[model samples]
Target: MVGASIANFTEIRGYIKGRAVLGKSATEIFKDVVDIYGKGWMSYRTVCRWAKKFASGRVSIENDTKTGRKVSISTKLAEARIQELLLEDARYTVRELAKLTGVSSSTVHFILKKQLKVRKITARWIPHLLTVEQKRSRVQCARKILKMAQKIEKNNFPDLVMGDETWIYFENYEPHRKISNKVWATKAAKRPCIAKRTMSVRKMLYAIFFTARGLAIQVPVPKGRGITGKFYRDVVLKKLDKYFGKIQPKSGMRHIKLLHDNAPVHKAAIVTDFLSGKHVTVLQHPPYSPDLSRCDFFLFPRLKKILAGRKYSKRPSVGSAIYQCLISIPTKDYIRAFQMWLKRLKI
Candidate 1:
């Protein structure tokens, strides 16, 4: 139990060497030897092991994990098992994984909480109406790009016009609410047509382009009509002819691509023949795929913005106002809206 000589770092190391050869335990070594180097910061057990190794003349320091030897889960194994379970069934509930892994539910919960990092939920599909198959078809019809080489051979792509008609009835306003819920309930009981004042109006059919980095009106229905397959071919083809007929093939325009939904008007017999005769390639969107349609996604909102909160005297008056507003919305805005589709097409 003699005090060691005070010295520089080298002298301290030498003192540690002499004391360690004298064979002291970790408590003794840490109290005396650790101050030699690294500014007295070498840990207690660390000091003990280095001195003992030096005394025994062991060639290597044995670095190891021995933190009190408490039982612990193998993190690597836990991660691998978690991944395996996730792949086998992505929807596997956390509780279910706990049972399968024989791990405590709390531990499984912690793992998922820390690492799952899943996104917030979103809508899977529109309610009712179109089946899964129908939604897929509609997007394809609207967005499909064909090589205009065949069009170059004959020229119809620039003439390609995609048109869709959508409804915006005044009666179609989102169900109303009031600040005073109790007072409004009785008033809300009556049907919107009779009780809640509304004047429903129809929007004219709209047709536009989805080609060569642009979109514009081929023909817009200045006045809307009840949708049917027959009306589409007849009305759509005629309007296309009226507008695009003016463009010559040598003007660098080729092939006409027309897009519309699988509504009754689109598949009319007269419409098919009209398209074939004029060399217009009519593309039918999948039913229930309105989410992808330009009319549904782009134009209707613009029209709604035009009509939003607008009070009309009657249905006919509303229709007239809509027509005037339609003409006012610049073609470039519609073009700008369709160009947004390009962003979705990217990876």
Candidate 2:
């Protein structure tokens, strides 16, 4: 066995020689070495090979001369080629970039980070693409709501009823894994896979309504019944009545401000008239703006994170888990979300 001092000193010298030095953590350095080399090389296998050479007092642990690897990617022409490859496919992995450019992964990375100054990030999933008019409408609607919230200032804040529907699957989908952006790390080595049942007919539509104070109610929408205007008027109305019987005007707030997305059922004429009769004011919501929706941005993710990896065989068990998770959220969180909603309107 070699001494720790000798191993450390040799590793430093090796780094300078190849311009890609890796230390022994068995994991990070192994990844670093793999990034410098292409994916054709084994991470641990190569690390162990270098360790053996270092033990025998070899000065350079890298397989080849630095000049040989650097020549392909260091020139102005090579930089242009690398940029063209990236422009064609922004999602290309570092290993893929190296393979396509016919250069070492470290070289591809150098041209990308040091030269290009561009980093790859995951794009957020949106419901649908918004048009220029839809974006203008969103900003206009936000302004109207902000004015409404302020105009009625006597009540500390009006009672805001925000509701949304989401399907709760019996088997949770594994979260999208992130690709490693390390100089040498590959996606194949870093992705996580959890064992879960793939097929299950069991699922439920959960309709949740909340106020800044806390959850008003979490209703399980009747099985086999799609959310229609009739359902909102008859079924959803009854549920709301159970909690807030006969909407009454409070100090400075003569009506409860209801906020919901632009779903077909919610926009139906019958539903609008029904809410009007009940004196529940529907706040203007921009189409496809889940970022503006409190439930979409906050409640759903919080509940789903707690439910991740939790297996439930029956409806009651799933309901219980959801209830516990929702109630456990601090009241301050809801207040903060409301504050943020107001802030987003100005932007």
Candidate 3:
């Protein structure tokens, strides 16, 4: 977080500020500083920048060192610094200005934004333009549910794992391509035939249910879309046998929190029975909130990134690639994504 200065900057800084306060443009300042400092001390860009900050009031008059060289400042300089910063990159942080202009963070922040009438950086939460009743109801519902979820989320159990499944595509391996309007040899890009492999061979479906710790088994879903009671029981539940089988059945044995969406397959009586029998409590995510699903928003994207350029022709095949990719993604990203999910609880 902390490191020493990349350059010996005081003298050069004062030189730039002096010129900047003299009502000079960055280019003009750059030329003057180079002429005086002779390129041995500071780069044109760096010096020009310090001048701009000083003129804009980002570098305060207080910074004028009385010893070797002194940079003069005026009221116009402070105002100029403010205008320059806003007209340039308004998003430039005070910390960034401090580093660039060799001024204190507080000085830059106060001068550029607070003192000089620059815009404040806030969330800018605009109203939804909703009907009065609808907006009121939405706010009320958000507050009510947030209150309940907050209690459970903060206190009910620290060991919670929300689960969701996502599809990983093999086309991510395909090189970027472009089509020409002029002509082409043939349409090798024709859609896949329905007559082949009953619509499953184009890409195999894998179900991933993961959390902060790790994921359960990921396997090929023969029927990805139509996973019913029978299919869910035999294929999906059977693969996750470790979750219930000899993996510790009692509470607090592990950080065992099962989160799933409102999908019928997930809510099926049989599926509920399997989860409950294992003592894995289900956290119900709000409808249409796949963004809240950790697997969907976080793990699956990482899996895709890892397998971005890889193809099924490799030794272990697509299935193997996905399994490793699942675990290979840094845990830090996963935890960060979890925190993001937690943030959505209020919204």
Candidate 4:
């Protein structure tokens, strides 16, 4: 079969040489070849090159063996040196490693990939660079929360309300720009462009409160006002209390467990005192731990995703959009979020 294939290739080359001798154009010969053998047998450029060679009175149809030094630098010593350079600085680029090891970039790449078996990756982002003590505290807090969750009756889990505040910009790009902003276009077509803009300074701070049932209330902090302890106690907690009363008038604020982050405002005397007076059990949350917060991990992300890439002229419009997105979330998703929160505690 191999000998037959070789003879067939030689026949094709001889046909090209004959066509060239007959003064046929390269394009005409290429078309004739394509008509006989089909497209994948040979490219037009290859046919043109062979026709030119034959027209120049060349006899040999085989490829010329002209070459420079062959690359054989993927040695054990080179692999060891590459490994040492990577150990010294893992951020070294392939070209940089090649220069240092006196090997071609392709050779260095082979050693790093095939022999050393290493890959480069971006550094993972974390909420905080935690110290040893902070890490210990996180584990302890997780254990305590897990214990509390196990003790709570399944039916009464809906009483657990998680709350957090985030700044909502009126106009912002989506978190996943690569996907959200992409558009279909032909290779020859000019690439689409979007104006490069920073996040809008015009934003509103909103405090969102939710339960396993769904969103309870979203309170917008008044313009020019920071989320001070006074503001939280007077505005945010008051609205939350009103919401609870409206929902369960008969059993107002009873068996309600509030889960909020360790923000300074939440830990303030006024906020703590107000919760105690209302008989609301404030769950112990570890500092710098957004992973454990239901709103941080679930609710806010969902809200932000829906709000991203949308433009709003006024703050009221932004708030309205946010409210609509919040109410649109299904109760089942809320239940799942709480379940995930408990699962994270176990982890």
Candidate 5:
């Protein structure tokens, strides 16, 4: 089959050379080939490329030797050096690595995959690059949470209400999301400009209190005022009281646990006093570990995806869009988020 393919390629080249000798243009020859063999046999670009080569008085029909002395970049010593350089700085691009090592980009890529066995990867965007102490703190916190969760699951799993706040930009939305309709068109057709613009200054601080069941309350913090402890207590706590009644924990279980990050407002004396006064159990969440937060991992991300490409002229509009998205989330999603939260605790 390989020999047959080679023979066919040679025949095609000879035919193209003959046509070029006859003073036929590349486009004319391409059209002729399409008429004779059909478009499926070869692409228009490939036919035109050969026609150009033949017109240049080239005699050889066979391809030039693609394999040479196996690139020196693949040598054991060179491979080892490449690996060392990559270890020193993982962010180096193929061109950068090639420049440093005096090798072609393709050769560098060959060394990376076939010899060094390493490939470039994107890092997840985290709020902070955690320090050793912070990582250790996360582990400890996870262990404690796991233990507490196991104990609670022995009877009935307590109602888990995870709360968090996020800034919602009225105009700014996720960049990669496809906002416009796509269609099949010619390569020459101008693509629609669905590119996103720079974020506008208008934004709102949106907060949510939700359980595995569904969203309980959503609060849009008034503009010009940040979430002070007093504000958090007044807005969130008041909403909490109204939802589950002044007695706390609603109707189902013995207790309700609140999960939130260690923001200053969350740890303020007023916040602590309010929780104590209301008899609400605040779950111990480690600092700077948004990965462990339900809102960070699941709720906020879903909200962002839904909000992406949507435009809002006013703060109320943004709030309304967010509310609609929150309410639209399936109960299974909320349940899954809590389940994943527990699994992450084990990790």
Candidate 6:
């Protein structure tokens, strides 16, 4: 075999030109070159093109340089530019950044990801945009909860009952339809279609209370009636009180420590007076801080996920489904949720 060091484009093209002058066909010339050099030394089409070029009185064997835009390589300047662009507007896409920075999309992506060590992510939705005072209040409340949790015995954690109110829709559409409805299919098979359905306007306001043990009570407000301070105090708290009496007959509602969000109805004078009179200690909860609530973070999200993509014709059916979903949750999950709540408070 010919050594690679002795093999050059000029030398190979000259050999092809000489063979063409000797009346040798392109195919015969290519096979002779392969036998001398190697199997992949030159392709038959390349030999044929060179033979035609020699016949047309072409002398130079060197390849001509083509003219176009030079490929952009990742550099420190490009990385810095991408970082600056991201700082100016994080929403800038790879294509937009490429156009702005005078680089290809792949180059911009490489600099952003590999050099800058950054990744794009969707923004998380929070309950509210809190003011300075609200932020400070949340910190204070979190610290207080952390201290309380440290003092409480592990067994007595069940005494801390967390409750909240949310509207349960009769038909809850999946948040991500494309992902949830995805199915396995062959490449030739047509994609399946699903009819788009919006969230139902028909919903019932439900106040749910639970502890580390399990669900205590879930009260659905009557149709055409909204939650008022009087209703919450008389109806919601009354049922909770009854449940407590049935479970802890000796201690009644005295040992209960309620943790609920700071809705106007919950903070009303009537509700405050009722709780104070009943000796049910309401834990301190900062306004607009749903992240700290177990119901918001754990229970409601899981419940909604299970109920998503299901349609109910009647309100009673929805209520029954919710009941089943709630009870069906394993007891270990409730315990883990409470543990997570304490961990979050510490954070």
Per-residue lDDT tens digits for candidate 3, residues 1-347, read: 12223333565576677767778788887777677656766666666657767877876533545564333473346446656765787777767766656667766665665457566577565434457775565456446545555554554334555555566554455322223123444677655332222334356566776555565567566634655777776777665655544444554313366676788888889888776776665665555445557676677766776776665643237777787777776766656666676676556
* lDDT tens digits by residue: candidate 4, 243-304: 88998998788668889999999999999999999989888887787888888778987888
Global lDDT of each candidate: 0.56, 0.72, 0.61, 0.85, 0.79, 0.84
Top-down lDDT ranking = 4, 6, 5, 2, 3, 1
Candidate 6, run of 10 with poorest lDDT: 1-10
3 or 6, greater by TM-score: 6
lDDT score at residue 261, model 6, on the 0-100 scale = 88
Top-scoring candidate (lDDT): 4
Q: Which segments of candidate 3 are over 4 A away from where they belong? A: 1-158, 174-201, 223-226, 244-255, 313-316
Candidate 5 lDDT, 157-271, residue by residue in tens:
4367888898888775546345444767799999766545454567888788887767888998987888989999988877876787733545422357888889999999998
Deviation of model 6 at 149, angstroms: 0.9
RMSD of 6: 9.2
Residue 35 of model 3, lDDT score: 78
| Cα deviation of 211, candidate 3, in Å | 1.7
Q: Model 6: residues >4 Å from true position, as ranges?
A: 1-75, 92-110, 171-178, 181-201, 308-317
lDDT per residue as tens, model 1, 1-347: 12232324335445556677777766776676544454454556656656777788753333444665333556446756987888887777767887788787866776676556553354475456766676565445435542333442243233444566655554334333342223334654863332454444433444443333333343444544454555566665565565554555343223566667676666778877777777666655555555546666776666666775566545566566666666677766555554553333221
**What does the lDDT read for residue 289 in candidate 4?**
79
Cα lDDT tens digits for candidate 6, 132-249: 9988988898887777775554674857889999888887774633576788999999988765645447888899988777888999999999999999999999999999999899
Where model 1 places Cα greater than 4 Å from the true spot, the runs are 1-71, 74-79, 115-123, 126-146, 149-158, 175-225, 233-236, 239-255, 283-292, 341-347
Q: What tens digits encode model 2's per-residue C-alpha lDDT throughout 122-240?
A: 99976799999999999899878877767543343447778899878776655422332224647677644555534455778888887777777787777677788888777776687
User: What is the Cα-based lDDT of residue 194 in candidate 3?
Assistant: 24
